[model samples]
Structure formats: structure tokens, C-alpha cells
Target: MAVRVSTDTFEAEVKNGGKAVIADFYSDSCVPCKRLSPVLAEIEEEQGDRVKLVKININFDGALAEKYGVMSVPTLIFFKDGEEISRLNGAVKKSEIVSEIDKI
Candidate 1:
């Protein structure tokens, strides 16, 4: 399962994590976010050893979203070694997400 993160926990959970981190910036009211949740969970289950999945609710953590330049919901930020390597916006396919994960 993807862990919920707020501005206070963002750095500790994502920036300081050892494995590749997928920071999902989403909103509870977003349909795309709802659709992406299960996909992310599946990915987390399959790649638990290689990745750390964390979710930042944009509605609650607007500051964190602003800091990351997230203009919309369901944005995925991929980090490796505490730095952002890539990102995906909107509803993305599982293959696309997995491909990006494989690269990092």
C-alpha cells in the first residue's frame, strides 16, 4: 500500500529514503487519482523491494504540491537517491510508470 505523506513527513519519507521513491501528488476528489490508486498499489506490491510509494494529498498539502510545482492532481514524481529524476502527469499506464521506475 502507498503511504500517505504530508508536508511534515515528505522529506523524511521521500527525500531520505534509500530506495526509489514515487511521490504521488493527488486529491481525494479527482477521478484520475482514484483510478491510479489501484495501479500504484499493484506496482508497490510487485516492486516493494525496489521502491517506496508515498502519497501527498494536494488538497491537504498544498504547500508541498506548490513546492514541487504540481499544478494538477495525480502527478507522480520519481526520485532516486533523494533527487527527482522524472515525473508523470495525469492518468498514466502501468507500463509507462514501470518503465520509468526501471530507469531509476
Candidate 2:
């Protein structure tokens, strides 16, 4: 399951977790974000305890979006050891996401 994130707790929850974090920076009004939600869920399900997903709504957490330089919705950023290692934008296929995860 993806953890809903806010600017206030984004760091504590993602950066310091000591695990790889897949942060999905999205907005409710974005069609592509909606399309990618289930795909992310499937990744989480298949990955099991190997990774963590953090869902951040840019509408409510604008600061986080700016900090991460997310100019668009559905920006998937992968963090390991509290640092960003990879990213993907827009609605992407499940295989692409899995491939990115595998790299990390």
C-alpha cells in the first residue's frame, strides 16, 4: 500500500526510513496519475517487503513537489539510503517501473 505524504512528514517518512522509497508525486485531477495508481499497487504487491511506496499529492503538498522539482504529475522518484537514485514521469508501463526498481 502507498503511504499518503504531506510536506510536514515527507522527510521523516521517506528519507530516514532506511529502506528504498518509491515516491509518487501526483495530483488528484491528473488522469495519468489515476491510470498509474493501480500499476503502482501491483508493483507494491509483487515487490512485497522489498520496497516502500509513498504517494504524495502535489495539490496538498506543493512544497514537496517544488523540492523534488516535479513540474508535472505522476513523477515517480526512487530513493535509496535517503537519496534519489532514479525517476520516471507520466503514466508508464508496469515493466518499466519494475525495471527501474530492479536497478535500485
Candidate 3:
């Protein structure tokens, strides 16, 4: 399962973690966010050892969203070695996400 991150935990869980991180910025009422959840879960299940998945709820973590410059729901920010490497906005396919992960 993806870890739910808040501003308090974001740095430790994402930036300092010893794996590639996928920070999923989403809103509770977003339809596309709902659709993207399972796809992310599958990727997490398959790549648990290689990558780390974390979720930030835009409604609750608005500051964190703004800090990351997330302007939309379902924005996936890929991080490696404490820096963002790539981002995908919207409901992306599992294959597409995997391809991005592969780059890190």
C-alpha cells in the first residue's frame, strides 16, 4: 500500500528514502485520482523493492501541493536522490508510469 504523506513526513519518507519515490498528489473527490489509485497499487506491488509510493491529499496537504507546484489532481512526481526527475499529470497508464520509473 502507498504511504499517506503529510508535510511533516514528506521529507523523511520521500526525499530521504533509499529508493525512487512516486509522490501522487490527489484530491479525495477527484475521479481521475480514483482511477489512478489501483494502477499505482499494481506498480507498487510489482516494484515494491525498487520504488516507494506515497500519496499526498491535496485537500489536506495544500501547502505541500503548492510547494511541489502541483496545479492539478493526480499529478505524479517522480523523485530520485531527493530531487524530482519527472512528472506526469492526470490519469496515466500503468505502462507509462512504469516507463518513467525505469528511467530512475
Candidate 4:
């Protein structure tokens, strides 16, 4: 399962985490964002104990969205410590997301 993030927990949850964090920056109103949720869940399940999945509501805190340059929904940002390492915009296949995660 992924943790729902907001401006409140954004720093501690993603930036300070010891493990690599994959944050799915999205909004509820976006169709593609909704579509990618389940695939992310599958990634979470399949990679249990290996990585952490976090979902950020771009609508809740636009700063994070802007900071990451998330121009679209379903943007996936892979972070190592506090720095962003990789990013995928729009809804992507689960396999591709996993492959990106594997590279980290």
C-alpha cells in the first residue's frame, strides 16, 4: 500500500526516508491518474519490502507539483534520499515503472 501525502508529510516521508522512495504525484480529478493507481498497487505488492510507494495529491499542495515540474497527472518521481533521480510523466505501464525502480 502507498501512503497518501500532503504538504505536511511531504518532506519527512519522501525526502528523509532511508530507502529509495517512488512518489506518484497525482490528482483525484485526473482520469489517467485514476487509471494508474491499481498498477502502482501491484508494483507495491510485487516489490514488497524493497521500496516505498507514496502518493501525493498535487491539488492539495501545488508546491510539490511545481517543484517536480509535474505538468500532468500520473507523474512518477523516483527519489533517492531527498533528491529526485528519475521521473515518468503521464500514465505508464507497470513494467516500465518497475524497470525504472530496478535501475535505482
List candidate 4 stretches off by more than 4 Å: none
- TM per prediction: 0.97, 0.95, 0.97, 0.92
> In model 1, which regions exceed 4 Å deviation?
none
How displaced is residue 42 in candidate 4, in Å?
A: 0.7
Q: By lDDT, rank the candidates, best first.
A: 3, 1, 2, 4
Task: Determine the C-alpha RMSD for candidate 1 after optimal superposition of all C-alphas.
Answer: 0.8
| lDDT tens digits by residue: candidate 3, 7-79 | 9999999877589999999998999999999999999999999999999999999999999899998999999
Pairs that collide in candidate 3 are none
lDDT of 4 at 82: 78
Candidate 3 weakest lDDT stretch, 10 residues: 10-19
User: Each model's C-alpha lDDT?
Assistant: 0.94, 0.90, 0.94, 0.87
State the lDDT of candidate 1 residue by residue for 45-87, as single tens digits.
9999999999999889999999989998899999998799999
Total clashing pairs for each candidate: 0, 0, 0, 0
Q: How big is the positional error of residue 21 in model 2, measured in Å on the Cα after superposition?
A: 0.7
Candidate 4 residues 2-104, lDDT tens each?
9988887988988764778899998889999999999989988988576789999988889988988888888899998878899999979988998998999
